[model samples]
Target: PSVQDCTICMERLSAPSGYKGPQPAVKPDLVGKLVKCGHVFHLHCLVAMYNNGNKDGSLQCPTCKTIYGVKTGTQPPGKMEYHIIPHALPGHSDCKTIRIIYNIPPGVQGPEHPNPGKSFTARGFPRHCYLPDSEKGRKVLKLLLVAWDRRLIFAIGTSSTTGESDTVIWNEIHHKTEFGSNLTGHGYPDINYLDNVLAELAAQGITEESLAQEKD
Candidate 1:
């Protein structure tokens, strides 16, 4: 195969690794291809990439973002509860409401965090998230359940809004938490939220396609 520069270090694939980042002590001078995606990366560069990551026993291809293992999250200990409520939302009065409650407490970072020994704050505990009971909403709910099981819902890191370090934060996937009012920009009457979230889930490699591959 033709040689290409390593994505991590910008060094030629045939040359000795030149990564000056935090990595394992023994750096191997070899280029390896991921079996699933067939994306080539320097062994040492791959080592550094994985080492500097969350180390949740998963590796995503740097080029294509194809996940290798079960992608876990840095979400701190929390509680997630969901149930059907009889109340109707603004846009969908025919269907009931699906109430999801998430409760995360403050705690010290674990091995999966950026700073393992640092203490993180849970700004919001028992956060109430909402969903419609429509067919698309139910499909979104199923994918969300998979995301939660993989710990992809929430993560431990700096808050983007508050700029506070070492705190519980939401990941890329968005949730509609508000019920009746759209005042918080997270309420009902969002006709496209369910489809949008499904797209987000697919971006995170949590779609039905990935699930089918796993089953195979």
Candidate 2:
């Protein structure tokens, strides 16, 4: 028989590995119970998933609602709910209307490489490169995400292996993420990392229903 897969962690089942996870009391018949784009996972794994999606304290589908977590949209700008709920990106052919919220702590940065701190905090970036939201802008954003992992702010900015920071390029990324033109381009797919994150958000109960209720 084929092994069952865990959708949340994208892992396959096996005899206990040299790690920690509960052995199921019953063979899972998840083939019938699993939801599409959803995963059947251990409670511990589910908690980890929850923590990952709750990065900004808001829980929402990374795929559907464009970009919102457990809160916002439904409620007025100032008011906020105390609890987190499953949320999904609003299903639309166009997700440009969506924007993800990012918190900027006093100290944070991105990965280390030829291009450092590329997609770090949402602030202090120029607006030109960010505009148009093209492949280039997203590439920059991805780089920054990598850089932010390292918390290397000073080392941030797109510098070449030649050891030079491309101010023009860096500033442009800043622009696009912060203030850019209405140039919507499509290079990312629905099954990419962002969408994957959204799927988890959906599991958290941050769906369209939450948005509607929050606005009330």
Candidate 3:
């Protein structure tokens, strides 16, 4: 087998893996392969990676980004409610609006968050997000539902907008919270909002490919 350097430590596969992570040392490090992706890493490095994550029993191969199990998120406790509204967005006048209501209250952080026991800010409650109730929009909604189930919609960390730490913030995906207006630039009437959000979702490893793979 052709040996590759450990991506985490930059050491040869044959060399004993080094320890430079946050975990305490106990045993000598060895190497192993992620059975699905065939990506190799030091066993210690893999354990460190897992420990640094949500510890949700799923791991992504760092090299290929292949997921071994369901990917959970660092979103705090919240409620995701959705319903159809009678109003139509600017660009899509043919269909009604699908309103998503995300309600997360201020609470202490858990082990999944950055600082456990520290209070996190929930700047907005019942934040309204919008989408068209069309075929493609419904498809996006379905995937977003999956994203919600995996808690990928929001996360607890530093707020980029306010630069506040220990706060509830949106993840990499963006949402169009404005409806029936585009004055704020966050509103619709732009023709590419749905496609853009879909691309953002894909960046987070949520896409039609994941939906197709779910059936298998």
Candidate 4:
């Protein structure tokens, strides 16, 4: 049998996984291949990696970052609403605007949260976001809807602005909180915003191609 390195443990596939945690009672040389990326790894190494994570019932290939299953987050219950506005943003005067509203309230953290049983503060409610009503903007809206469904929109964590912990904050995905101008740097007029957001969404395993795959 050909020998290959398990990226997770940095060990040969022919050897037992170098995971120092509790070991699974499987063959030392047993290897498993991820279905989507087709990257192979020692089964024990994969199990160890999964255990180290949030155990969210999803696996990400370390080599290529290809997600195996639906990746959900611990975002608390909230509402996401969007509508077409008649106004045009600064640089996107050619089309109307798409406004997104996210509303999350204060609540006790669940077992999946960082501080379970502790109350979290939702400083902002009904936060408004904006995007141009163009073809690319609409594509971003569709993917944002998917991200909201997966609870990857907001999470309870330390606020970078207020230095307060246990508060509802935006996840890795960025949004245009400013509607008219780019004063806060989160607004429009930036030509790369759409493409940058698409990359961010891809990082979270939410892309148009992935969405189509789910439908199929």
Candidate 5:
């Protein structure tokens, strides 16, 4: 009798010994069900095969074959991340906000642009760089971001820290600049500046989870 081919696609696995780790024995009823082969193939492997050429239902499985499912192409989900340093001033509620402004075109102000003026509406989680009513904490936050990421720093409110860059008084900077941002329309500052900042965060693997509240 001719040997039957394993439905599971194991061609990708170069080594055959103990292949795909320890896969559970296939169920007897699953035999000849057109299952996918691999070091470790899932039951759903068959679904992909069933729908491979399907326009309406494009999915197939290694076993039981040709599962009817809708075609799903990869799509990018646009998201921005940031940490918030809440109001540094007392009795003031600094609406935590983060913005992602583009260096070029369509400006981030087309109603949906994550501009800093309304930082609260930007993202649900903003990192508190420094605690309110604490001089030491604010200094610490300023130091942390600047020291760790090599990012230039600035701030709004009624204080200043003499970093390599001047402690830009936000209001004064605002009056001088186009957005009254003095720094960049609040936290916006220079387009290149923000782009670099966000890029730095990306490099550090700053994801949605980075916005969690600090436990101090």
Candidate 6:
């Protein structure tokens, strides 16, 4: 069977890898197949791609986005708590609300952090976030639990708002912090919040499809 081009470097599988980094010691024509997706790519290209990333011992297929190993993050230790709230959010009056609370305290950074041995400030302890208990919202919650398990919810870095170094910040995933209004631009009334959050979660490699793949 003829293998398609390597999506990572956009080169035919039979040819040498297009990776221009320090050359890997494998045969130029050697290719590797992803176990789950069965996609083949030049071994050298895969090595370069993995090196260019966080190198957290995981590989994601560029063609099908299948994750090969557990994906983790450099988020400092924290607590994630969630429960059902009786009151409904402004725009989601049809169902009850699910509130998630994240609590991370000030701590020294580790080797994986941006600055090891430096103190990182967690500005908001027990930050509150919300979502409706609808079907899609529950789906998002399930995926969110996975994200938290992988430590992808928060990270240690400089605060974009205060410009303070060695601080904790939200890691890409958007949350609605405001309870009643959209005043802070983080609140509700936006029809696309659920879908938008799903997209954000997918961008972090925490999609529902990936979750199912893990189960398999």
lDDT of each: 0.83, 0.32, 0.83, 0.89, 0.29, 0.86
Per-residue lDDT tens digits for candidate 5, residues 91-131, read: 22443332222111111222222232322112211222212
Candidate No. with top TM-score: 4
Q: What is the number of backbone collisions in each predicted candidate, taken in the order shown?
A: 0, 40, 0, 0, 39, 0
TM-score: model 6 vs. ground truth? 0.77
Write candidate 1's Cα lDDT for 54-108 as tens digits.
7878888988888887777767777788999998888999999888888888989
Q: Model 5 scores what on Cα lDDT?
A: 0.29
Which ranges of candidate 6 are over 4 A from the true structure? 1-42, 61-66, 209-216
For candidate 3, lDDT tens digit of each residue in 45-98?
888888878889888888877777778798888888899999899989998999
lDDT of prediction 3:
0.83
Worst 10 residues of 3 by lDDT: 21-30
Candidate 2 segments exceeding 4 Å error: 7-14, 17-38, 51-210
Question: What would the TM-scores of all predictions be?
Answer: 0.86, 0.28, 0.84, 0.87, 0.18, 0.77
Write down the worst ten-residue block by lDDT for model 6: 1-10
Model 1: how far residue 42 lies from native, Å: 1.0
After superposition, which runs of candidate 1 have C-alpha atoms over 4 Å from their true positions?
1-3, 23-28, 209-216
lDDT tens digits, residues 65-163, model 6?
777787778888889999999988988999999999999999999988888898889997889999999999899999998899888999888788999
Q: Return model 1's CA RMSD, one decimal.
A: 2.6
Clashing pairs in 1: none
Q: Candidate 5: deviation at residue 114, Å?
A: 26
